[model samples]
Target: MAAVTSKVSLKLMIDTESRRVVYAEAGKDFVDFLFYIVALPVGTFIPLLNQEMVGSLGNIYDSFANLSTTYLRPNVNKDSLLSPKAYYCGATGLPLHVPNVESSRKVYRCCRNVTLDRNETCSCGATMNQESKYTVLPSANNPYSSEGDFVKGKVIYMVMDDLAVKPLSTVSIIALLNKFNVKEIGDLEEKVVDLGRDEVVKLLKASLLTKTILTDVFLSVLKEEVNCQQEVEGNF
Candidate 1:
């Protein structure tokens, strides 16, 4: 997995009256990160949220964490469930930077061409653990050949508050505006927000628990800033 050091910028269209994010205008990098969310394992969500997931899955994960190794099979590793790797065809370059979650690597094979574990003996009895590097060869059928993960690069996308994604277009924007009953363009505000690891993590959590994902993840922060300013004014 490539280290994503740079932050992705999202141009959010917020409804001031509703205190909600109507949609976000995002590029390939942000879209790629959104698409990558589905590829994550069920177990990974717990660690990503620091065990604060809003369901019984957290309890199950905690139970497993406290389980004794002596009662389990020798082949079973706790880390396997706690930090299962997600396989992606191409580099996602997500800024989330999940600690143990990583993209899948090439499968290890024995010299006899039998499927075998790395450093373990095969049925054929040859201990040749040949490591083959996996590469996505570009072809006419390959959609990922150009750039980006899941979606093609160089195009902007529209991301709804509920995490629904689509290519940005005038029609789509108008449709969303109509759906939200947005009569006045003056009520809509455009804000460019920088999404780093912390913000992305909050988004991940919000996506799981709330339908108004963008509003829950971002608007609350804006409300806090407003409240702080009001408090300072009151102090005067």
Candidate 2:
């Protein structure tokens, strides 16, 4: 069963120092903006943009001959073995956290035929196997097919440090957690430890889609970036 994001009341949040309109969400309109907000801070905006928006942005590769169509296509080649796989909540058919697991693996294995290393451990606290780490718990939003793409027997868990390491920025992660009704870092730490890495990732990422996070994040960004004084009526 997919988890549907809960609805939240409308409120404007402000970023006093930067004076930038960071969040501008209200009602269902705000829900559409969550992915955009996440992509901006992370600097992976191009991949997430829709074709209509991409078209308005102009040809990504106008100078390169015959490449306009190529850039306009979907972000990845679904059939390519090298294409990146996105994770999702097994219960909800939404894009979940895509952890940076490849970097955290202490030991990298090329194939199943490779000899095991006795002294290696993955970020998830398991002995490393195949060199790359991937999630197979059923993310409906994932472009790749789970059957052909993921290893059959590997134990998949959410990765904590990966996004933190992406240095997704302290504020963003906290904001995401807050939307999930997680109030403090200590609570999140315990939750991560209790739920294990994979579940935490799913929970946090999926939580972004929730009405609480969506509204909070939208208002938070607006408080930070949008010119609230002129655009909005009063103080947050």
State which candidate has the highest TM-score: 1
Can you give the lDDT of residue 146 in candidate 2? 36
Deviation from native of the Cα of residue 116 in model 2, angstroms: 12
Instruction: Write model 1 residue lDDT over 76-175, tens digit each, in one string.
Output: 6576687665544544445445444444435577654633134444556555468866566667775444233567789989999998999999899889
Worst 10 residues of 2 by lDDT: 157-166
Q: Estimate each model's TM-score.
A: 0.77, 0.20
Give the alpha-carbon lDDT of every model.
0.74, 0.32
**Backbone clash numbers for all candidates listed:** 0, 20
Error of 1 at 53 (Å): 2.9
Write model 2 residue lDDT over 44-159, tens digit each, in one string.
22223323232332244223323454674443322121122222223222232233211121234532432223234434445445554434544676432432232222222222
- Clashes counted in candidate 1 amount to 0
Candidate 2 error regions (>4 Å): 1-144, 147-211, 228-236
Deviating ranges (above 4 Å) for candidate 1: 1-3, 87-96, 103-132, 138-148, 226-236
Which candidate gets the maximum lDDT versus the true structure? 1
